[model samples]
Target: MSAVGPAEALILLVIWVVPAVVLFFLIYWAVRLAIRHEGRRVPSLHERVTAEREAQRREWAEREARRNTEAPDEL
Candidate 1:
């Protein structure tokens, strides 16, 4: 059996390690992208419009109450 010198051993380790590291990163990126795309669809337009209208109505009501309190002279 031939003894492996330091340079030959190092080369072999790098060959094995580099491919494993690259494969790990590729798998990680693919899984991350898949998870991110999984939630791409959310709140239909109707739902979004309803939510916005509700928020605007709430704001308008608060403003009206504040104006009435400040203009007691009008009452």
Candidate 2:
């Protein structure tokens, strides 16, 4: 077989190097994403509080609607 020329060598280098660089970045991003949510629980403190408040507001609205629909008993 004949030896590769400069142009052929540059093409080969790019073919291998480009995928390697892309794979490296993909791995880096995966690791970063994993760490970002590491050691954390779902429905964190703030979220739990907000959810509770929303539920309470919904309950209050339902009670008010029931009161409005009920007929008043007059003497």
Identify the leading candidate in terms of TM-score.
2
Candidate 2 runs further than 4 Å off: 1-6, 9-41, 72-75
TM-score for each predicted model, relative to the true structure: 0.46, 0.50
* lDDT by candidate, in order shown: 0.93, 0.89
lDDT tens digits, residues 1-75, model 1? 999999999999899988899999999999999989877968789989999999999999999999889886653
List the pairs of residues colliding in candidate 2: none
The number of clashing residue pairs in each candidate reads 0, 0
Q: What is the C-alpha RMSD, rounded to one decimal, of candidate 1?
A: 5.7
Question: Cα-based RMSD of the predictions, in order?
Answer: 5.7, 5.9
**Cα lDDT, model 1, residue 18:** 86
TM-score, prediction 1: 0.46
How big is the positional error of residue 46 in model 2, measured in Å on the Cα after superposition?
Answer: 1.4
Q: How far off is residue 52 in model 2, in Å?
A: 0.5
